[model samples]
Target: MKDFPSCFGENGVQIADSSSSSSSSSSSISKAAQNLVTCVYQCKLRGRLSFIVLTWTKHLMGQGLSLQIQNSTSQSLCKVDIKPWLFSKKKGSKIFEIESSKMEIHWDLTNAKFGCGPEPEEGFFVAVVFDRELIFFVGDSPSEKIAAVSAAAAVFVARREHVFGKKLYSAKAQFSEKGETHNVSIECDTSGGLKEPSLVIRIDSKTAMQIKRLKWKFRGNDTIVVDGIPVQVMWDVHNWLFGNSAMSSAVFMFQTHKSSGSHSQSSVLNSSSSSSSSSSSYCQQQIKDSKLQGLDFSLILYAWRNE
Candidate 1:
């Protein structure tokens, strides 16, 4: 899969080059650890399937939001950026054209309430209308003006978030479109004077997966069952184990996969190698293939350690 940092693109955040000076590399990675959340939804635009990407960022001025619509081939159709300085322009609409179809985006965050994260907890509405038809809608209270289009209901496909904590990192995820939201907690003890560092993952306060001897198995994958659904958990923590802890962030992926008579959970875990290269390749292939069928849900987490 593409590294979580790449999803931010030019707006902000990027992976540092290996050849860069140590100080420069540290600055780059530190910038990427900022608070941000990106969500992907699959919906129909002009009767054709498309992907809508929404990114929420937190900065010194205030919160920022950006929207991008892309075709099946991942080509950008159009994009809009609502800067943090434009806080007074809370409620507005943007008009554009895509393939001769008039596309309109309306957002109202006048009373939007937010917690520690960039995403709003409630009191907001963002609607996407194509040719005057409501194709996508999000937020707790949608505007009373926009009518709904049944055929254009979007599917929640993927999410990427940056979480920070000392030892226990937590986030919320829904494995399927209709699935229940569950609390996800990742705990790893890597303090000094500790001989053996281990990793533990919990869902809704219940242990789902655990790893021992994390130093040796810094990168690996396993299968866990949550809400009777099989979720493939892959993690890469080489940086936290050996690299610069202050500037490095570990990655975790939780993906729900379909089970067939010929395929077994054991096979999936066994085929996975304890190396970053193999793990990355497997994840990219799975995501790329599943997007075509729209049958899987992916949750990616970038965990930053607190110094």
Candidate 2:
């Protein structure tokens, strides 16, 4: 497995290849693995920059959750894992000592409602308190019992999720912090031999981008406008077309690029014909470098094809 720092580089964007062995193995896991989602949030702990990672997983037995607090250097300050079968431990709190400061984590999942994914769709809250002050919290609604305290809000930095489908894969994404969540779908027909394979991406059911010759452009980047903001859409589908196993998956990344404009879009589209290796590296560098400027949001989707 890739280290947390390497997966989420200095800019808070994932840097590994989507089609690598690590990604493939992760995608090939059991059906329960499809319920996994990892989200990274940036916030302040004791006035110092830190990250809070929440990983949600689902198993045959039940839903599982893990939380980790890391400093600017990606060093773990505190880690908590909630076992899936521990139904009685749904509502609880834990305290940890970090550099002489006390950090408290409280969670209430007894009334949590879950959808197809492991993450609760509503009716739950996870709160983090540092030095007796509320630092971060996430959920549909906060309980009246947990007092509301004023503090710096956490920034949603990045999310990595696994999606499964045969020809159409869909997920929800928000390009900006305050942006509206939109339905993002990817469609490609590689099953039939009669017609040439092509790729199509849609936002809110409208076609945002399309690639005519997917075989030649299996791994490339394109610029698509979302919420009037320029987003760089990079995809790697080499495994879908040529992998030996049916479980191989394709990887897609949707990133908001504040610096990208209309002029650069045409240039990037023209350069899509470059070799896959160079194109993949160039796209990775583009995201890695963009993160240094504090890009708000990035979404990585591993689309697994079901046989």
Candidate 3:
């Protein structure tokens, strides 16, 4: 059997379309901790495009990482898992082969630092070398050494995140490769009873956007400015309003665009994208393509309710 790549694999949690099987989502969300996060980076190697998924896991055991590299066709190329129980080491390296190419991945976090989340905050380094060329390097490692090892072959392109909260969900996001990362949060309280529900999103403690009467507007899109850049924000809250206990979630996509006149318009509701058919490959393709080139960077969020 071939090992397929999934964000939920290493964590022992596999999430499905809440709109279809709300019970499963509810059970899985209840078992999930709050400090876990997954990041997917679109990269280029030898003129070919691919994605690198880095999942940071945090539990009673400790902090670890799960990495999956896949080609543009969504086929899994390689996967590296650093499980806490099996290795008990703070830092190490792994080697693997892809189509007969010798590839090496190295990391050093013996003296690494971390914040409240599973992701490292400082004192860490991760490098990827292929056939003696440094394809990618991230951390405090000397920049000159990286350039000397090999020419730059990989670039951080896009990312995705999974956030959980009962009323407020937060995450750090960089709208551009060179943009400053800001603290962003989404606040919503649907316990309106007989009144209208409200949705508020803030970046760096500054209000960037707000939606009133979210119950009536369960699915839609709009433009919001974060750090002075126009970002198209699309949302689907059907599950929040009417999902079974297991299906209580809201999906949001914040896409940063380059053109100024390209956004700030109301979007037609697209139910087919996040409908019960969300498990379909077509839906997954649409979700991934939401970024790419003209669309630039995107922050996809799946906010789960604890209630």
Every model: Cα RMSD to truth? 5.0, 3.6, 5.8
Q: Measured by C-alpha RMSD in angstroms, how accurate is candidate 1?
A: 5.0
What is the Cα-based lDDT of residue 116 in candidate 2? 79
User: Once model 2 is optimally superposed onto the true structure by TM-score, how far is the C-alpha of residue 288 displaced, in angstroms?
Assistant: 1.6
Report the number of clashing residue pairs per model: 1, 0, 1
Worst 10 residues of 1 by lDDT: 8-17
Q: List the residue pairs that clash in candidate 1.
A: 1-284
Clashes of 2: 0
lDDT of 3 by residue, 1-307 (tens): 0011122111112222212333444555534434456666666666677666666766667778777777776677777877756456666678888768877777776767878777887787777777677776667743344446855646554455557787899988988777898998999887657768888989888898888877666676777876667887767677787765643667777777766565546653445544543323322343444444256566667677776
TM-score of predicted structure 1: 0.83
The list of candidate 1 runs beyond 4 A from truth reads 1-24, 86-88, 148-151, 192-194, 258-263, 266-295
lDDT of 3: 0.64
Please give the lDDT score at residue 276 for candidate 3: 43
The best candidate by lDDT is: 2
Candidate 2 lDDT, 1-307, residue by residue in tens: 1111223535342322223444445344535447778888888776777888888888777888888888777778898889788454888889999879888888989889998788998889898888877888998666664566655568877788878889999999989877899999999887868899899999999999999778777776777888888887877777687777757567787877666456234223322455434434655665675566445577878788887
TM-score of each: 0.83, 0.86, 0.80
Model 3 misplaced stretches (Cα beyond 4 Å): 1-25, 141-148, 151-153, 268-293
